[model samples]
Target: MGTATPHGARAHARAQHGTRTPTMPVVPATDWPAPPAGAGPLVWAETVAGGGYAHKVLARGTELRLTDLHGDACAHLVLLAAGRPWERFNAADTVKVQWNAYLRAGHLLLSAQGRVLATLVADTTDGRHDTLCGTSTLVLNTERYGDGATHCATPAGRELLTLAALKNGLDTRDLPPSVSFFQGVHVDANDGTLHFTGSAGPGGSVTLRAEQDLVVLLANVPHPLDPRPSYTSTALEVLAWRAEPTRPGDPLWDATPEGRRAFLNTAELLTCRGQS
Candidate 1:
């Protein structure tokens, strides 16, 4: 008979040692062209209170144009890496990359790893948007609104964190600290707090050119405005070019002549609709 292996010895050895495993698959970054000067028209609009909600995932190289159909609209924006949860937008990093306090056209939105996620191609105002406003959230109890039974809704910074995690296959538990937009900063006893601000002037707008595929989210919360006409849209369109073009440098950055025309046409359409 063949020599019988010592079963107890083999079992003990197996328990004492483990086999090596292969590493996880590495995902490569996606390459995409930037948004052209004249890309498209309005997508959609929803009327929201001072504190409402909006969110979207922008693929690599997709341009997002935000228009303040009416004046004093506040938009809170956040950025994240396509697949890495830990690699998200850091305000400190963005500020250092741009070498300025506020973000404006021609600025690059840098990720924690120093990667270019999006580029600020155009803006109606000087590059001075507030980054410390924070997000809105749902409130369980509030004396100003009503009794404990009544619930109030508001935007919150946590929403962006949740979306970042969801996209990266990570749980919301791992969301990092986030920044805010369209808000003002206040200091009380040296502790910083974000206060609600008004919207930009009517017809004011800003547009971002994506360097790579990006996911974006936006929202509108209830503020001091009539619930009706809180949000309205003129038009939304997408224009694609056959080839990638050079970045348009600074000055005259508002959309190429063609883009301006498309925007104006959309605005007129909206005006006509309102009249009807």
Candidate 2:
């Protein structure tokens, strides 16, 4: 007698048999590139499809890397303090405190409380990340594309992030302004006009080390200002591994007095909370 197969299982078996190509399984890659010296084993690794969302809670000493696989993905990110959800990323502080509008290696991402959230430890995108412009919204994306809802093929960045927030036990109210990597914006110094510079080319990557425990939300979508008429974006590679957090004597910690103060603030909070 033949063994009985459940209805769902029988359907799945038939579909698999008829399929020419199968999607990759969601499993950790056994062969990722080496991490920095003294770094721990990889903790997270995944590929985010275009117009997709991803979120993760990283420890204080971990490093997260985002790569533009095909030179068209805009990795929009929003960071919140894992221990204290109210303390989220402050873009104004990140730029004003550093006295620089552009982000690069050694730059610190600051929070509203004047504490450091993450540090830009490595960047290959030539400091072409945007600090002025945020992610795309459902309304704008809907106007550009036929549909911008989360259930559609071309979900807006805001909608994707909203989903990420909800998955992490938060709500829409927790959403904050985000920063975009790989694609950049240029401000006309003469007239204060913002210009979209497009992508930084393929294989560009940026790595950020967590200064505090963080809940990071990422959306890989087309930049709102992208000149391309169509809603198109390529795949994005997300990799994270354990790494040593910045210390007082680290070059990045002392890169600038303002940055140093921010790191000190972060350390004090972590130490007081016994998270250090």
Candidate 3:
């Protein structure tokens, strides 16, 4: 199953909506129970810094937490609805739904259909990160490392798209117009061409609270700042952790005001070294 590029996909979506901006509703971020231990299966694996491969998967009602085991690390992320392939991610909708431009702790990941796909339950940075950019693949041959290298393919932007398409039973021919992490965007000569600026460096982790079944793909490539030929650059390491759904009446399940307070108290106690 080959899919269209992000740019093409967006264009198609626009055509369907008559170029009108999609509507999204703001929702409060309420505390929800975490997932049980080991509920999510590891679909793909990669490490940060070592620069090997990227990770991709389709998750439903899952809580994905990308921890910067080491600070100053940046992970590129892309999300799409499992049910609707053509209806992809809309950053504007997400911002509108959250009632804020920046996503941080206590925000939700909104889908193009005006649904809450995930929630930002907790974040260290208070959600002051970039959402305009997405992730992509890398090819080694076309990079600055020189042609005819030891390996056939290195990391590049387009490869990630191909991998995602393959995993989703789609072909890689029609890649989507993807945003980059920590990449800068600007217009040139009245022509809209989003460019990458630089790396979305260390300790920068983003977590999404899955509202429904969704497929997410991630990669690490050069930023707009690099401006060199594309290549298949791998990550040093990549780790995927799912916060399994907690048991009924679990502290994390508290959604009401009173429940939230109680949950926080319980969480604090659990964090204490000598709590029973």
Quote each prediction's TM-score: 0.53, 0.90, 0.52
RMSD of 2: 3.6
lDDT of 2 by residue, 141-192 (tens): 8898878999798899999999999999988888878989999999999999
The sequence of per-residue lDDT tens digits that candidate 3 reaches over residues 1-276 is: 123688877776666652322111111112112322553543323344422224455355456656443433344555665646654556776666455555556555555555444556656543435565544333333445443222234444456555656767765543444534333344343775554434344455555555445666554444424455554333433333444423237443454343344334433433472422
Considering only N, C-alpha and C atoms within 3 Å, which residue pairs clash in candidate 2? none
Task: Estimate, for each residue in 133-195, the C-alpha lDDT of model 1 and write its tens digit.
Answer: 344333421222332221234233344335434654655554443443333333344654434
Q: What lDDT does each candidate get? A: 0.44, 0.86, 0.46
- The window of 10 residues in a row where model 2 has the poorest summed lDDT is 18-27
Each candidate: RMSD: 17.9, 3.6, 16.7
Root-mean-square deviation of Cα positions for candidate 3 versus the true structure, in angstroms:
16.7
Preferred candidate (TM-score higher): 2 or 3: 2
**Candidate 1: TM-score?**
0.53
Best by lDDT: 2
CA deviation > 4 Å runs, candidate 3: 1-53, 68-73, 96-99, 125-128, 135-154, 172-201, 226-238, 241-276
